[model samples]
Target chain A: MAAEHADSGFNIFPMDQFVIRPLFGNHGMTWYTPTNQALWMGIAIVAVVLLLVIGTRGRALVPSRTQSIAEVFYGFTYKMIEDINGKAGLKYFPVIMTLFTFVVFANILGLLPYSFTVTSQAAVTVFLALAVFLSVTIIGLVKNGPGFLKVFWISSAPLPLRPILAIIEVISYFVRPVSHSIRLMGNMMAGHAVIMVFAGFAGALGIFAVFPVVAIMAVYGLEVIVAFIQAYVFAILTVIYMNDALHPGGH
Target chain B: MASEQLMAGAGQIGEHAEGMPQLDFANYPNQWFWLVVTLLVLYVVISRIALPRIASVLAERQGAIARDIEQAETLKRQAVEAEEAYKKALADARAEAGRIVAEAKADIQKELDIATEAAEAEIAAKSNESELRIAEIRKGALDSIEAVARDTAGEIVKAIMPVAADQKAIDAAVTAKLKG
Candidate 1:
């Protein structure tokens, strides 16, 4: 028992779980190294394939269970995009669906013991957010030309305050990806860390360890819900941002 | 021991900051590459294969249901038309039956009227023949009585005066007496 250590081994390395390491022999990490992140991501990809691709192979009018699960995800993503962005935004449906399924699968798979959470990393989330941001900006530019700048102009505001509001709008516009990415990463990382911290208490508590174990169970359940919600939030935010790109003059 | 070595390795990797591995910038490229590859695969599977297949299945189902409903409606209309034809045939048959029955009744009535008239005429002729035969029988009976009376009177006169009576006078007396 690690509890035999001096001062009752209270070594609770919550962040250690987030540490990236090579999946095979520990070698220096390069750009193309196969890491645990890649393994779990691969697993997430397999999950998506099993659910969306092979699951719907039946193509039944009356769907089977796995097919229904795939349809639920599809319907949920479709409704989210259509509700926020309307018909024009459906062109970007694939991107949003990918984002949703990736985040959801990654987050949920992270809940497994000893499994690495891919979405918890700032690098991955930041890239996703930046992808949405850059694409939406380019789409706005291409679609609206100079008219896309009107998103920040706030024509409804009084003339004198319009410039200040525009400045704020522009800053917030750039800040969107930062908030978007951090929100998902922070939620995943924080929940998992909290569960780890709680599990760490079981070592020293002995008989009272039941409390921490129970708390871990409770937090694990909450994390499961948080995992789905964070993905939904990410996908919906992407749709909303895309709506701004599609109809920049509306805001 | 593994935890310690893992911590040591992690620590060695980030000599300056052991706080959060997420901030470690060296691993960013590895994460980015795999993520992009995975997303590309998912996007291809979803947009290219899954979504369109589901949409077509749903559309096919919709079309099938519409076609079934239309077929049912057509069948129902045909049934209605058949029923109408049946009813019209029944009504026409009933009317034809009624016409036949009326014609038969008229024919029977004319036959009955002709029979009744022939019976009445035969009865009238039979009654006239019977009256003529009764008048002839009465005349024969009157002649027989007159002859008998004349013979009896002549027999009485011969017994009293031995005189013979005339037949013509007897007959004239008898006829005058019968008339009175």
Candidate 2:
């Protein structure tokens, strides 16, 4: 990244923004100390509340602008939950909805000029992915009892290879959270960092900054799509995991 | 700003990536603390406030649309029913009018028959009276002609035979000639 910026002599500090710092001032680290991550995450929650709760306060049959937007998002998530996991899956809709709303808002707010992306940290995303993973596993175990293990035992495979495949399935199942967390964190961080690098270039390029600015706009557009897509992917994957727990299948 | 930071050491690239802050385990505790706090808040807001509100709005709209459609269907049904009633009434009225017209035609025919019978009777009575009056006139004219014949015969006899003929004979002869 620096080699490309050599002509402009611009050294971008894109990753520095991800650092969790004390919200009050430069102070020694403590768990109780409110950090920038907390501040932004709090803002993300407020943003969601504003969009959904306050936005649809009227509950008009003929929806207003904010009401329509809220209703559209609500209907989308509702349909997604109903279709992906079935009506029985709606029992866990609140958790899934909370996660989706958080991720979406975090990504969108992160795109704002100089706003911190809460989801960009592995610390945040990993916790969310782990929560989903643990919940689905527990639910599967609780609901299916010993039958939950049937998901790993592939009866269709040859007896000799069945155990090997089961081992692979267990490993892959455990690896889900790692991939889930990393995917969102990496995507969010990469998009923002790339934009920051381009913006850094535009800073030193003087009148010729139009090219980098255009690239930034294009990447920004792509990142917007990525943000929504990542949220959808995370939520849908959660539904799939729940489905597995609800009905453990083999091969 | 990065160049000044880079002057500190060649290995330290800049504040940008001089240290991978995302992997900084020291900051993880505080980040996790906030993550949990904010997540709780978001969950409360979404499940308690946002989700229900938005769900209700969507449901309300759906219900309104369904009600409107049902109302329109009912109205359509009513219109169809009204049209059926109108058609039935029109058919009934047409049948009644046809019956009335038939009855009126029968009544007019009866009145015409009665008037024709009365007029025919009056004409027949008047004809009978006129026939009687003609017979009487004919009888009167015959009597006058007989009287004149008798008188003329008597005079001719008196003049030719120089004697008066018998009255009874003259009358009988006139009567016979007239009958022949």
Candidate 3:
């Protein structure tokens, strides 16, 4: 029965469906289906909300297990903010923590079998990175006026070299969001693709599938760890970006 | 050939010409719809109800730590005061002991002085009494000697010479002998 089905070219696990396709014409880059990505995003959001509600609803001085876990996450983010930007950074706690929790849950959810990895798509990661970039830039400008431009220029070198170095600095500064978004998207996409390839191998190898199956299992576990690490890396980079915006100087 | 075969196998498994059930955001699965609804509810609850309570609890914890530190300071001060009082009491006890020892020594010295004075006075009074008795005995012995001498001379005169016993003679003889 399996040979008959195989001869008919009927694949049990569809891999091509994950491919990006163009939505429209003319400068319309190929992108993942928004529907699938949005569904995953919705799931991630719900997970975060459930965690917050349950964790915060019954807070005791000596916390419940859930509350303690939530507090640890909260404390970790709080410390990260404080360490990166000092006491003044506390004002951005809500946004930073929200972003951290959202991204982390989304990445972790992707590791589940049959779940869509929304963070694997460039569009979603780009949107997040661009949002962070625009907000930090605007905040810097608002806080420091036209002087915020000095963040890419005057802070790096002596006055005589400012004009020449400013061009290079500004170019690099603009590249920040691209690199940030691509880093997360690339890691997640590569990890998921590798896992899919391994899973497919297990199916293709038939009776001699023990090695492939073990390898796929090991890769799946690693993907779970990678998901969390990618989220943390994204959040940490966001903090560093915000710090540069706020400080303007290296100090 | 194998790739084509795999694609065919996948298509047969999927069955639907368009492939695995494509997600439609407009008409999401019931599970996802309910998940969104639950998430919206939770977001409201967290922003409105949960976050404020957590903030207050954190504030309370900070206040508790401050209170504990202040209470510890107060207890430390009280301990210092108690220690000072204890030291003062110990010092007073030592001083009192010294005073008691001094007083005892003085009392002993005073008793010793009085005893010495009383002993000296008794010795002087005994010496005076002994001297007075010696003088009286000496005077009595002298008088007795004179009386005996007078009686012996009178008898001597009566035996040796037949002379009448006259008061003038006897008195002259006693007087001459006493003088000699």
Candidate 4:
């Protein structure tokens, strides 16, 4: 198991599990080859279906535990979008729920043993962030026309500082996706790596491995909370960004 | 052989440490494909089923609440109206009772006045009849006394001077005395 990592001092290859390997024998990965990443992604999807869809199939007047959970999750995302975007903003509630559940499921499933952290990977987050950024830009332009530019134009500032502020605003607007993607990916990757580092120490310490083991348990519990928070933060930010699209020009 | 195996392993790790696994382009299409598929599935399921059901339930609850409030308002108004009707009926009944009492008092007062007048006339008629009866009794008593006195005088005369002499004279004397 330590064969993959070169020993500067320790042979703990934390990054090895993140590698994309073919599900079949040692064959080359064609586009169709089901990699570990794809398998986990599918599993996350199935988990979402079972938990949300089938669990709430009863649609009872008085909800069971599973149904209540599904409805609560639904209402949480719905109210979040409504509060940030207003009534007009709630039109896009389905999209927001989809995005939230995607990140939420991806983050949670990735925490399992021998599982790939789909959201911790840059490619996945970048794709989602870019999609948000692009679609927001397009939708704002389409709906508000040239008035969409008014979001960057701060009218409350002194007239002389408007253009300078607009430039800063524009820069910040572009910087959104970079920060958005990096924050989630970085948090996930960092938490998992820290756990791995502890794992490596646990093996090396032998007798006092119990300390690291205990630490791992504590961190793992925290990661479960972090997983939910990151998803929530990502969803809230999406709503806030979408608000700019819905109300392009205001104080 | 072990050294050779170690060299092979080192080479493999070196190839992996060349860059991050995610940055590898070969895995991109497959990940992208599944991402698209899963997102579509989630979107369809959430949009078509779960959210709609919750929304309908919420709307139904809101409607029920509104209906219940409207019903309560209607009942309250009806109760107020019913109380008003009750009060009005009570006042009417009281007024009717007052009229009834007034009619009865008038009728009773008229009957009492008539009875008092009848009783006073009867007492006056009885007093007049009793005064006439006393005068008649006094006259009868005077006649009876006169008759007794005359008879007694005649009886005395017969016994002493023999005969029915001076009957008329005796009666004249008695009558004169009694009259005086």
Candidate 5:
């Protein structure tokens, strides 16, 4: 492992030191772990809770500026849910809002001087993505009963092509969570690593630092915009999934 | 020999590093546990708290707009009624002025007719009295002239003939002169 670490140009990939290695060996265990990512997750949860608890406690009619901003976020999420799922979708507004806020905060927080980005780790993003996937699948099954299989194959095409298309459709459906998780993790990990390398260059080339510094600044600005966009993309996907579960007309 | 083995191992590692990570669901054991917890918490919060508040706020905003429109309609109706009342009052006032002017003109005409009739009666009475007074003056003058002529004739007869101065004869001559 040490030789592998040395072989890499830099130690950018997470290692066992960054994870909480399980005390005992079990049937399922990994050589790699993500302890820093777990810690960041805890921080994200606390921050989200603190913001929500304080923001919603008073429930004022004529909102203060702070309260009004909170209201706007809540309103935006509600409208998104309504547009995607109609009135029935309103029930999922809080989850979508929380997910959006947490992911965005996690992304932006990683841009801070000494902060670790939890979302950059595959495990963290995979966990969130899988949860959405399972819930949507379960909702579809519960709502449609045996008819849920029609979402994949039986409802669309002729009988001869149904089996062939069903297999492909099923594989794609299973791949949704993997793609969703990897997309976010890969983006965050790549962006952070690039910024780190640029900052390192600025540190190394002390006298002629202007180019590196400007590059870092530009990357930072782009990261901030990406942070917001990733959150929106995640939330919008969740709404689309909910829509699929509710009304499976290939939307 | 050890140096050669190490170099070969390094080459193999470099080659393996380029390949993507294997799909190892077993290695990622905590995935299921975290997924369950996150989903449960999110579902509970969404169903219980967040959605209801948002819906109620939207409903309230819609209600307020409807109420404002209703109030505006009522106010417009009241304004129209007030305008109609003002126009009606102005029309009544104009009609009253016209009636009063016509009545005054009729009263002045009646008074002028009565005054003209009274002046004409007074002038007719004064003219009749003047005519009666003139007739009396003329009769008196005639009587005085007749008496003077008779006295002059009697004096002339007495101077001419003493015998003729008898009372019966002088009386007969005077009577004849007066007659002629």
Candidate 6:
């Protein structure tokens, strides 16, 4: 096995896969340039449509196999919002469902060989987090007016401690997007990189590659679980933030 | 030697100045643009199409189940009512049969009483007619015996009497003897 690529030189750059490049011919990257990132995002969109749109086309009372899968995704997201955000937060279910489906699809799809993870990129996750953060903030402001600041006001604390608590709350509030975005991106990138590293070991270990191969299998299984869990975490955190925004007084 | 080569590869990449591509800012816009487009498309498709269809199907199934339960309930009630009606008819028939039996008994008794009375009246009339006939036969037998006795006395007296003496006296004596 080592002799397979021995002539090409012993090179295994795990980070090389993370490099963003144009999907087409080499050129200066532009904001609107269709990159591999865009291509993978497009694939994720297609996956979502196939599940949510085409899968449910029958609208059968007794669902088809694909339709049942589609409904499970729908019901799972619906219940997630309702449980964490409560009935009032149900109004924002579609947007949160979008975030969930996109992240989940990207995470799982990236597990395929030669596929780029859209969520593995900080820029994409940041955009997603910012969208949730911005929309929830504006919704709070518009729905609750000046009262939305109550989320940080900490009225339950002792009068003197209230000011300090409020400051802490405000800082934590602003830091939400940073942690939210990085958490997803870091998990995805770390898992993929570790798997790639193990694969490189398998390549270098030749006939004794069984050790790294087994390790890759174990990590790959763990990565599959992590992929779904990370998506769940992202969606659940979005619900919590939305809950905070919807009912700032409860903070 | 392999380890050395791997170490050199890592060090060379650190000097490449590209670092982690994720930290690179130049590709942000492309990722952001595509991400927003994908999210927007998902939101429209889900809210506009999928959610409502699922909700309607669930509601329809709920309604169908409820209707089926109602129909079954109605059928059960009708069955119960029919059973009650059948029981009532059965009871009525039993009572009707009992009344018919009593009426027949009464009619038979009345006819038996009338026939018994007629037989008794006929028996009484036959006995009265037989008694009248026996009384008339006894009276006739007594009259014959008296006539024979009177004739025998008169013969004896005529032979004995030699004297043609007083027919009037003889007649008076015979009448007086028979009377005595």
DockQ-based class of model 2: acceptable
Q: Can you list the residue pairs that collide in candidate 1? A: none
Please, what is the whole-model Cα lDDT of each candidate in the order they appear? 0.86, 0.82, 0.71, 0.83, 0.67, 0.82
The TM-scores of all predictions, comma-separated, are: 0.74, 0.77, 0.70, 0.73, 0.64, 0.72
lDDT (tens digit, per residue) of candidate 3 on B8-127: 433433232233222222222332333344345544654565556667767777888899999999999999999999999999999999999999999999999999999999999999
Clashing residue pairs, candidate 6? none
In model 5, where do residues sit more than 4 Å from their true spots? A1-35, A153-168, B1-84, B87-180
Model 5 chain A weakest 10-residue run by lDDT: A14-23
- Candidate 5 per-residue lDDT, tens place, B4-99, comes to 533442343322222222122233455345434544564455446644554465466667778989999999999999999999999999999999
DockQ of all candidate complexes: 0.31, 0.33, 0.10, 0.25, 0.10, 0.27
For model 2, residues A1-251, the per-residue Cα lDDT tens digits are 55664655786767767766667755465667877778888889888888888888887778789878877777777788888778888887787888888899999998989788888988888989999899989988999899999889888888999899999999999999999999999999999989988988888889999999999999999999999999889888888887888778823
Query: Higher DockQ: candidate 1 or 6?
Result: 1
Q: Is the docking of candidate 6 incorrect, acceptable, medium or high quality?
A: acceptable
- What clash pairs does model 5 have? A18-A35, A19-A35
- Worst ten-residue run, lDDT, model 3 chain B? B20-29
Candidates 1 and 2 compared: the better one by lDDT is: 1
Write candidate 1's Cα lDDT for A57-106 as tens digits. Answer: 99887889998898888888888888888888888888888889999999
Top TM-score: which candidate number? 2
- Superposed model 2: Cα runs more than 4 Å off: A1-8, A154-168, B1-16, B113-180
Question: How well does chain A score by TM in each candidate?
Answer: 0.95, 0.92, 0.84, 0.94, 0.80, 0.93
Indicate the residue-level lDDT of B17 in model 4: 38
Highest-scoring model, lDDT: 1
Better of 3 and 6 by TM-score: 6
TM-score, cand. 6 vs. native: 0.72
